[model samples]
Target: MLNRLYFIFLLVPFLFLSCYDSNGDTEKSATLPIYQDTPYLQDYSVKYYFNSSVSPKKVFEDRNGVVQVLGKNGLYRTSAGQFLVDGTLIADNTYRPLKDKSLNGISLFQDQFVYVDDKAVLSNAWAGNLFLPHDLENANLLEPGSNFDFLISDGKELQFLSKDKAPWKGTVEDGNIIQIRYGHEANVFWILGKNSVSTFDASNNQIKTIKINNEATSFDVVGAKLYIGTQNGYFTVDSELNGKPSDLINKLPVPSITWIESIDEEIWFGSDEGAYRMDIDGDFNYYYGKRWLPGNKVVHISSGHEGRVHILTDNGLAQIHFDPMTLADKAAFYEKQVRDRHIRLGFNASLVDLKNGDVNSGRLDDSDNDGLWTSMYLASQVYRYKVTGNEEALKNCYESMEAMERLFTINDVPGFPSRSFERSGYIESLHDSDRWQHTDDPEWDWKSTTSSDEAIGHIFVYSVMAELLENDLRERAITLIDTLMGHIVKNDYYLVDFDGKPTTWGKWNPEYVNARPIMVGDRKINSSNIIAMLQTAYHFTQKEVYKEKAFDLMNNHGYFENLMRPMSEIGKAPEDADDWSKMLSEGWNHSDDEMYFLGYWGLYRYALNDTLKTKFKESIIDHWESERPEKDGAWNLLTAVCETQNFDLDEAAWYLREHPMDMRSWDVKNSHRKDLTFIEPNFRDQTTEEVLPPDERQVQRHNANMFRLDRTGGDGSEEYSAGDIWLLPYWLGRYLGVISEPRLNKE
Candidate 1:
């Protein structure tokens, strides 16, 4: 129902729904600058709503140049950016006040406005009072063509009527007729009947039917070609491409066609699925439920003054306006856009649907690492709620927390988070090569033997929630953290699976972490993670055993030295080293950077005391200084949370802003751009001359190289969401007091 949009209440805090009016008179101006510097971007849209009971039947601009809308019950008038129903202002602009009116369609002729009521009464609106212009019968449709020349069809006959004379006629079958139009220059009139197209000379003499095949739903004449719209889709052909003027192989991207309108260099197709805009370049901008329309059921379209196009849908009336905006505003707008686009609500549950590009409008499926991504998204909201006291943000935090905590109960293993979870019978396995376990409950299945990444995520989210959420939720956070941390400590610092052995990457025993040389990134990262988890446990539970274990890893086993290694100090492993360690050290460990920074929040924030922070300060600054060159926004904000060094807030904002609005994981090519300066490729395979904007780089996670040259469409691309990537830093900035609120001055 249209009312659902009003109560979808937990939408992004920044997107305020303006009162929608069928009269096309919402006060939102599309001219607000998006970016303060770059004002050339013409990317802005506004949504309008009508009274729940008022659905638009037709819409047009009046002769006086004001927008007017015809609703199921009455006529709506637009004046001075407000819609008035029967001359009375309604409290909310979303619903236009309905009043009794006799007219439902309008036209202009010889300076006199013609209005047609449902009863087939034709009145001259400009004659000071309602008066019939001519005796009419079954005039259901108005063919408003030239000022003096037009035809009205009541099924069997087409009346060639004039403002001052009796109507003349031409015969046609009732239901078989589609539409008719007259060409001024050619001095001929054409009839687009369902089965065939027939033409006549200006004198009304039949001039034979054009050779044709399948029925044409609608058609437009431009020069020598006919643009045909059909149930099968759109086709274009020369007036007589062959002996039989068959439809060409061409088709629009939509499923079925209803109406076609051509505007300047663009062609618009209104279909059963939605509206499509194809530019001269053949690129398409599809409008569907989430982006522009409240629903995809488009009824009719009317091109209005300027670049605006009015779309009348079964739900309400809306207009699409194009205007210039700045890049900054564009960046801010996308946050709201991505939230609505990627968030999926189902069965009282919500999750960040990461692979939106893959699913499009379909339902979202769980990724192999749903918990990991949800942890990051959850952390961002935790920060937002703490900073802004926004109830919506807190609600989102609880929803994701509920999902994250499910990972523990999903399997028999006490605290092992599955690689992913899904309804039973959907798939046989999580990975083709890895074993997937079926839980005791027959309704669900979850992947087993989860790696340390899940463990780290559990600790991070739980630690943050424990501090930020109130009473009951805070107590719940403590339970999750203690259970996961207790599981690790109980299994000799490893994530034990259902089969009673440590998961491959979950091994954090001193033997494994200290087994590799300092040059291997894993040695440093694993050591850092275990210590952080131990410390976070101590902070939440105030357990003496957690602090003792952290000290044991730090002092006896040299985990402190391992954690303190500067990021730049690592290099290729020694030639004589083990095979696995050498292979790991062959290149910069970008994933280690992700794991290290993600762990940093708990490592430093919940440190046992001030002295440890003072001792760890240099290591933190050095690591950030080395990472500053890459300009990773997520890492920078995590580093800023340590509060021991200066952060590049502008650069962080740039990374978030420069992140592309088009989150589709399409293959992007920036290596060939003339604007790029060539530079030597790095070990991580980044080939850009310099950091091209975030939009041009390979679709990435916080773990991937930010400046990597090419983005592989869906292949070699990680399943990621703009929400987690954006939310991570945006909330971090908020927590750091850098970004207070979005600068969208006018909602």
Candidate 2:
């Protein structure tokens, strides 16, 4: 009985449900009409908002050439499109009154305008209506005490409004009104407040709020995205009433943002400090600060047709042309051009003498002859850049090298060697005293000869160059080196005098004995010459004999051990004790204090043992942390060491920070004019009007104040010696990773 009753109930329901189709066949498909939204394009000539302390906020626009504005004075319109306010009358062609003296915030919707000031109003030339309270200032459009103009669409047949008290507003078909938009295709509107943002949706008639913890200083909207500038940077929202907010990417750290706008999908934010621009996807690429912009503060941004952006700032107004392709191409070109120029200009060796020619001996001697050591060092740096894809500068380096090869001889024997002299042994420093010796003063003739000190530096420079040249040049260089070694052996550890006797002073000073091979007072074995010879050999041949020689010089009786004593232990007091001592310690006293030779000492140590490396590291660290005079001392010392040792990346960076090279301070001293000035180790000459041509020899006393990592001050102390700026690139390039390390064979 229960089963029969259950079957009857199920069958009755099935029969009633199946009777839907008149044809008695199971339904094929249900038909529902597709809904399509109508698109409305608003024609606006000019749109702007005004906020003033004396009046309420206003939204004004010129639509179809007619000017209208909604402000605290109420909804206003003119047939002639002219309005008067505060003694100023604005006029245009056609105008209609949208709101009387009761509206403030207004916006255009198709052919009509919606506003709420003293009242919630909607108007057009055909009709006008006012609803809700006449005083809606405190209504909650999105946040308390905030209101915004409503957004409308004809397809939606509704408007989305933001009010302080109601939060949202909408119309009903039954003639009833609600605080939200009633249709499905309603446009979204946003309400901005001092520290909060509220969004209203016309489709859903819903309101969503986001409170910015930081003060909302400025705001702007671009399509579906909303941007809000706060006290601490800026943030963006995806849509009107949904999704989380993201930061306005790469906002500069300024006190506050005063203005913002959307132009061609890019966001332009103006702060009290400067202006910045970012693309729609939040990529910050353009920034105009005090460096580029005339004013520190930006006032406003306006967008015109065809991707034009105009900005108004505190200083004035500016227009920038932004084309991605052009900017990128220009930047690439600039980088390549600068690199090529730097290489070419640095390697021109004609500026200095390292060749077998008499270039510096005649007219060149009248002008300050640039040095041998520096020119060669610069050539090396130029080559380094050339090998790294900068082919345009190679010609300059090759030409300079050609000139240098012609200036020097392969043997101590006087007179120039012919091309066949390539197989000759060793090279000698060419002492061209005749060029510098004063014709009017016989006493100066004997004083202008090449010093042993200068010869030592020349050897090191030649050796380094030989290592870098081609095979044919290397063979010639090897012959020169052999010839120099033979000369040294024949002189019995001393340079031979012009008369062939073991005189006190050979070419440099004929009056003093043992002076040609002397050291700082009371110190034994001034091994600067020996050290250079060994280091040069090591560099060219990588031979153990040279390394052993360098070690022997550095160990006990070398220049290093002699100059290592505490500052107080050496030198006598001059009339001006303080100034004299300072000068002496700084390597100004070439006779009694061996401080001037520290650069060579560092080079020798670097080429020899590990003990010197440890010393150099400790000295630099101490200098970096010390105070005043000691700091200066440490800085000078460490810079010299770093250049010679060729310390790797980390060490070089630290040294550079400790001792900043201030080139601007370089100047010349007056005292140098009366004496011979040595620009580099092997380059020295008397300072006549001709030697340092009157035009080139600037008399600014500040020149000698500058310091370089490698070059020491010249005797006259005017301008940098040839090697100062030239050798810098060689060491700096190595430290900066511009050159690859030469592969070396391990013992």
Candidate 3:
């Protein structure tokens, strides 16, 4: 019966439930010059899977725009679309356009197809064999020479074949061959063996081999220079093919290179762990894990048609496609993502139990902070609606607001909201089953143990809606505010659960708030949150008692002093403190960071007087100063609400732009990077001297440690919803007038 109720809620019509009013728009800025910089293109990837029966070794792009996957057994082709869409790997056929079943290698010579078999080298522009003296049975590397010739290697010797000329053979002095490439500028064929670099002077039939001190792994010849990769790092050789190689350059994200390819004048390196490209700015854009590839063991890197990158791995292929998109465009994409698969009973939820990051194979699972996540998603829609006056955005706000409303009504307790609810009879499968209880209706069960996190989230969204919406929606928002604050005040500042006891983390009374050490984060967070909740309630409801209680807590209970404590002073509790306070102050609580920012919305925005508003702004800026190292987009934008001039707007833009398009929780590792500066472990859990780009680290929400460098033990079974994580800051930036309109094609 409860499952039936869940279906009924899912089938409700959205169009008839809400409408936007044109008269209730909020006042905000038109543009901020500092944030008005031109936008750049964003990179998103589409993965292509291969058959388990095939072992893919290389990937290539043909002139006809088809992707060819060359395997150890045979070759295959996938006719991908022009734009970036997930591709389907075609199996069971080798692309034998030349009808040569015994073809050993292929290349492009003067825009024509060149095919080579064990007995012959052939091309479409030339009839019969160009050179057929040397055997090609064991060939691994193939390339076009500068003078219309072909250079092929079998990891032991190179076969230089030309029309009507005898094939010239060369081998390294002490090592097996690996790569053979012709440098156009040097007019010589560069050969790379296991531990040496050998150059072939075809004009004089002279072969020169330079033995490397380190164990050479890979090499790429760009123009006249040769870049060699060793076990430790990589370095470059001079254009003259000089005596000794330069010292190994180890300043890289990952230095153990496996393969290198210079495609379209850009160099790409593949390592045993991942792949990265060295941009013109001399910095690396690291692509690792399932977020960017099928597997971290990258076999080869090549350029696809029209600047796309085809990365071949042991598992399959990952094609990274770049496109120009503004933050608004990105928000629309995430908007669809939430509406399509992430919306579970109108609460933003993650898609879990996925198979190989396939969205169809996942289900919407429940979380302990359903209310908090939904409130963030709801606030994004609210800000989006106000920014564009979009009817769909307004409807989204209404639907999520209705879901929050049901959290209060799902249980019999007045003014108390459940953490989450689901159909009956699945208690054993649900998380925290001990906290699950049957509602008055036999068909449903609701979760208890709601914390202050959800409470502040509820108040934040409710206050935003009450101030920005009109008529029915406005009244509904204000009613929720009154209900929640009334319950807190009547019960002596606690969220009383159905069992009629204060839930853990929901204690904001003077006794509970003042009990912790002044250095503990909770002392400041709780005092700040309850005061903000009261201020929001008093502002919208025009209730004098809410105002009175707020002042009593601040003036008589030292709540103001607690809330105003500088963030620099927050650290481990004193040795004399109780165990609970010590535990609460262990390191820094990122959840407290999230909660503090959410509360700052009302604490600063709905201040009862200008003097309090000024004080609130100063406190917020102080906190933002402490948080500047993380470069968190949400925290920076939340502080932007205080209208401060220097809130790290540039860093916030970097956060939005540098965030990866893939939201899957893949195992990411950055502790191995040599380019990062490490700092001593401290109370804030900041391990690095500077934070890595969001794309290079583990994908997490606002409540996670931003400076965490690595995450292990993941199988890509979950795709986090960007609704709460990304859209909130993006839309909030739009509403705050920091990020401009789409700026389409501005880059």
Error of 2 at 251 (Å): 12
How close is every model to the real structure, measured as TM-score?
0.57, 0.35, 0.92
Give candidate 2 misplaced runs (Cα > 4 Å). Answer: 1-187, 204-215, 219-227, 231-252, 259-270, 275-295, 299-336, 339-391, 399-465, 471-606, 609-747
Best by TM-score: 3
lDDT of 2 at 350: 21
lDDT of 3 at 263: 68
What RMSD, rounded to one decimal, does every model reach?
13.5, 25.6, 5.7
Q: Where does model 1 exceed 4 Å of error?
A: 1-14, 17-360, 429-433, 715-720, 743-747
**Candidate 3 colliding pairs:** none
Q: Write the per-residue lDDT of candidate 1 for residues 674-717, one digit (tens) a residue.
A: 33456675565555544655654555677777766554434312
Weakest ten-residue segment in model 3 by summed lDDT: 14-23
lDDT string, candidate 3, 215-234, tens digits:
77888877667888877789
Clash counts for the predictions, in order: 9, 47, 0
Ranking by lDDT: 3, 1, 2
| Model 3 stretches astray by more than 4 angstroms | 1-34, 37-39, 53-55, 79-104, 110-115, 123-133, 164-166, 263-266, 745-747
User: How many residue pairs of model 1 clash at the backbone?
Assistant: 9
What local distance difference test score does each model get?
A: 0.61, 0.36, 0.80
